[model samples]
Target: MKRLTAAAGSNLPVGPYSQAVISGNLVFTAGQIPVIPGQHIQPETFEQQVRQTLRNLETVLQAAGSDFDHVVKVNGYLTDPAQLEPYNRVYAEMLGHAPPARTTVCVSLWGVALEIECIAEVIDHRLRV
Candidate 1:
């Protein structure tokens, strides 16, 4: 059975989609932008936007019983090509040593600077040997 999840303390999805969906052991998250819930303070730089976007992704992952360490793939989209370098820096720091396989590209994203999405393994820690 498939399960849909919406992080309790995160921004509600502006569209019709749920924040994430879980099918069996996999959790697939919708694209996460830099809109922090209840906070109107927008990021002033690409790096800050990257941080907020990743945090949003984290919320979805946690709600799905996963985390960055369990992520298997990532797809990132930037509004400008120049944002890639700074984005990577923050991404590396957030994901640490076992970063997931990723593909990033520049695209027109309306007013947002960037977005990130991922697929993760939904591991139940207590069941692990």
Candidate 2:
């Protein structure tokens, strides 16, 4: 079992613990705020936050040698339940047809409007690509 962390762009150990962890061919990402590269964690709109949150997820997934298609499940935590529709729409657009199984919950985000975490199975890249 190996605990995952930001591999390239290292940041302070924020909040409770590490950013991500991987074990037994599965990678688990900690809750990621919409802290895009060169951008603040705080964003102006729900749409922006949602995009950034997904981007952040993609970033970590890339670190794990996985992509959105490799994600088997996802959990979205939104500061506002009303943002569900827009979130779903955008998420669908982002991942195209092979959308991973997902669930969205309304919760109070610590410092942002949206946060998301996910579990992905690392696929054999050579076999596929």
| Poorest 10 consecutive residues by lDDT, candidate 1 | 120-129
lDDT of 2: 0.74
Candidate 1 per-residue lDDT over residues 1-129, each given as its tens digit: 355546887888887888888877888899999987778555887788889989989988887788999999999999888887888899999986897899999899878989899999988643222
* Per-residue alpha-carbon lDDT of candidate 2 for residues 1-129, written as tens digits (9 for 90 to 100): 666556454233466676667766777888777766654445677788778778777877777667788898999888777898889888888775798888889887667778788998866443222
Candidate number with greatest lDDT: 1
Runs of candidate 2 exceeding 4 Å displacement: 9-13, 124-129
Model 1: CA > 4 A from native: 125-129
**How many times do residue backbones clash in model 1?**
0
lDDT of each: 0.84, 0.74
Q: Please give the TM-score that candidate 1 achieves against the real structure.
A: 0.91
